[model samples]
Target: MTTPREHVRNAAGFALVWVAAKAAHRVRFRTMGSVPRTGPVILVANHLTMTDPLAVARVAIGHRRFPHFLAMQEVFGWPGVGALARATGQIPVARGSASAADALESASERLDQGQLVALYPEGRLTTEPDQMPGPARTGAARLALRHPEAPVIPVGTWGPKQGNGHIWHRHTACLSVGAPVDLSPWAGRSDEAAAREVTDAIMAAIRAEIAQAKQMWHAR
Candidate 1:
């Protein structure tokens, strides 16, 4: 449901993002599909670089919605970056705080209120090409189970390619989005095994999306 208010907000956010991406002048690349025009959705993606999230978000904002991300507390405390981060609806995580209950509360509040959010399950930035994704903390699973019906869209970027003042403007920046992932299987699971199973399943879905995106992007 793209309410009148959200519609207005999306349009405005898109404008700002468009300007910023254009300024970066990176040749923005994308494949897969567009973010749904209307829905309570969760976005999942790889964390290969510090800018990985932002690189992925460039494509997300251009789609039919505004994206809210889960920002680490450190980033949330920075000066201008933090201000800008909050303005974009970033859910800040005070990691090490009782299994991230605070962030979950914030995510639930936003999703229940009808918003799109981006998450990096790796819990931190990536530095290598061969690392088999950091063990996901399962907080994302907890978040999704809390809202069993929201659509979870997985996104993957080919690269910011090492250093980056701007990649979105460079023609080489490529991104791919997977269809919305559903975690209904864990909707009612009560055991630890069931929980880990569900989390691994979700992680698999995200991994496939990322691998496909990376392959397709680099092939071109």
Candidate 2:
């Protein structure tokens, strides 16, 4: 059941996100319907800049699903945003922990409760000059493999940042929602190899969407 505090938090968060999206000027949201309306969902997306989370949230909101991001533990301890994040139920991931067990357990609980959980498989912003997505962290795949009921959806987000500057000149960005990866084939295995395989498949889907977004950006 939804608590009064949660309801208030969600409403406030959505309002704030709308304001931020509008202030950012131009953004293109695509394939939002790929996320199902009701049920547990695990969204895996590529992270390029700090603005990626907001862009991803837009996609999820468009699909009528509220996204609970797997953010760093320190972020949840931040001054003002921390309180809001706690209220909104964002999962806190500890730094330097390879397994991210605390976060995974929280995420699993949320999934069992039929809520949408979002993660950046790359774990951090891209350092590459080309800004392509970095390696996939096993956490996302592990979560999916542990709970096979919730389908893993790959989301590609690009162009949240234009050049090295913070200001966006109404730049054209893309949020491509790819098809959900089928993980039924690896249901029983929770080993490193199975997790790696699932992570690769998810990454491939995300990369395809990224390529498509880049192509579309160029075409425009």
Q: How close to the true structure is residue 101 of candidate 1, measured as C-alpha lDDT?
A: 74
lDDT of 1 by residue, 187-215 (tens): 67646676577678778877776677667
Off by over 4 Å in 2: 162-164, 167-171
The local lDDT score (0 to 100) that residue 27 gets in candidate 1 is 37
TM for candidate 2 is: 0.89
Clashing pairs for model 1 are: 25-169, 25-170, 26-168, 26-169, 26-170, 27-169, 27-170, 27-171
**lDDT score, residue 10, model 2?**
81
Error of 2 at 139 (Å): 0.2
Worst 10 residues of 2 by lDDT: 162-171
Tell me the TM-score of each prediction against the true structure: 0.82, 0.89
Best by TM-score: 2
- Backbone clash tally for model 1? 8
* Regions of candidate 1 where Cα sits further than 4 Å from its true position: 1-12, 23-34, 129-132, 162-171
Best by lDDT: 2
